[model samples]
Target: MQTTLMIYDGTAPADSGVPRTGGVPLAPAGFTWPICGSSCGGPLQFFAHLPVEDGVLSVFVCQNDPGACESWDATSGANRVYLFPREELQPVEAPATGVTLLPATSAIRTHVVTLDPAEDDDHDELAPDAYDLARSGWKREPEERFGKQREVLGSLGGSPSYLEDDRLPACPACTDTMEFAAHLEEGISAQSAMNLGGRLGYVFVCRACREGAFLTD
Candidate 1:
């Protein structure tokens, strides 16, 4: 059975240039994703994703003042979108409805497209299985849903890479959100039992506000 997933796309504030979206709460973390690093600019919000074409890239905007780094224009160059193979996507079980994220195989071919401003987002005609795959990559599937604690902890070796859906940090100075700066392939872990899967994401602070961002992979 295929399940569906919900993903968000939004821009970071001018001070912090971290792009972000909403996700199911993960206990202590509350409403947040990975912060890239310090020296990020402003706060970022989740807007929407590009269409299935051209790799299904997600889009984020910079709501900072024009006087700031003008991240809105700078962010145009970022590879914010991603496309995943059908096998890599996962079906999340909704506790309330008991319905999975992807209800059918059609979800594997799904992609998202977000319009601007976000104030008027309406999926009136969208099917129930849209946004089935939240993360890409072969390893992301089991790790995200069923990977053991040790798997996530011990796997944090080698290079580091940022996940397309990570919640980057916002700027502290001007409060603009930061953008996806770069990905890290390798990373180290604190303990063997602390595996969130070997893969990890790194977000950077916005260049304009110098705030911190988060990373994911």
Candidate 2:
């Protein structure tokens, strides 16, 4: 099994304002901060700014109280995600009011890892995010076993992990079910993980409404 490999030195960089995944969040000329509808009633915290096909996927979540807030409740208004056309976008300044940007931005590089069935017949049985399984397999193999680690599950273009299929969210605009967009996890390396405070963030969007949502668990 060949999987996407990410280089994790734990130093992901962002643009001047937003924490970098692919740079700044692109919005129209008169863009304003996304209001958090959660009990926090503040600006949703900026989570990621990923580049999509000809557009940018901007993500944010509520940070009123990491201990008591429902950052994962879809209707709690704790999170927001948006995909804007690149041509119609511009860099955004971090809001002065809401959740503050993380201090360290861990950078990530995506590559690939090739798995050889010959290495271990049981290698085929490992789950996608099976870190323990992969580590065990490596311990049994000779030196220089698998290519780079498949890396943790949450990075650009990868499916969200730790989520139930039935939990797919609905788009607030069209009232139609939204599509699973991406997952944002701790940054590149364990040392510089995006400082998500151990919570995994998920991004969803409705192209028809040009709106998106984010949640954490």
Candidate 3:
């Protein structure tokens, strides 16, 4: 299976327009910073800025009260995903209060990884999850296992890792099942990672409707 992994490339300018996590989000003019519509009702924390084929995927989640707001559910209103046009996007002004951004801006670079099906003799024993396999095999050196795993910012394109069928989100605009867009890891460093309560973040989008969804698992 072929999986495109997003690797950390150190710090980047907040509005560099490159694929990254943290930093201020770039949006069209008149764009207002998203606020959590769930329980906390505070400004949502910016999670990522991902450049995709058609546009950029801007993500946000409520950090005001993690578990209390249900940011892990796509339709809960505590999280949001937007597919913004690549051009004409400007850095958005952040709110004065709430967790609106991470402590550091993390740059990302993509690496395509192909996992040979023939390499595993126990393939039949377990259902293969491409994202998990790719992440486990991302080490640069044989002994770099755990350390290298931290460098994985997430992935660009691939099936959702271990996501259940029913958990797939429906596009808010058209009510159609959204296509999997990306998977986001917490981050490279504990201090800079988006607070996900130790779970993985999932992004989905409906190209036809230009809508997106965010959830955690």
Q: Point to the candidate with the largest TM-score.
A: 3
Q: Please give the lDDT score at residue 123 for candidate 1.
A: 30
TM-score of 1: 0.22
lDDT tens readout by residue for model 1, 33-72: 2211212343332222212211222222222222233332
Q: Which regions of candidate 2 fall more than 4 Å away from where they truly are?
A: 1-24, 114-153, 188-197
User: Candidate 2: lDDT of 79?
Assistant: 70
lDDT of 3 by residue, 185-212 (tens): 9998876799988999999999999999
Ranked by TM-score, the better of candidates 1 and 2 is 2
**What are the TM-scores, per candidate, against the unseen true structure?**
0.22, 0.71, 0.95
lDDT for residue 48 in candidate 3, whole number 0-100? 94
Give the lDDT of residue 43 in candidate 2.
Answer: 72
TM-score order of candidates, top first:
3, 2, 1
RMSD of each: 19.6, 4.6, 1.6
Candidate 3 clashes: the total is: 0
Clashes of each: 86, 8, 0
lDDT of 2: 0.59
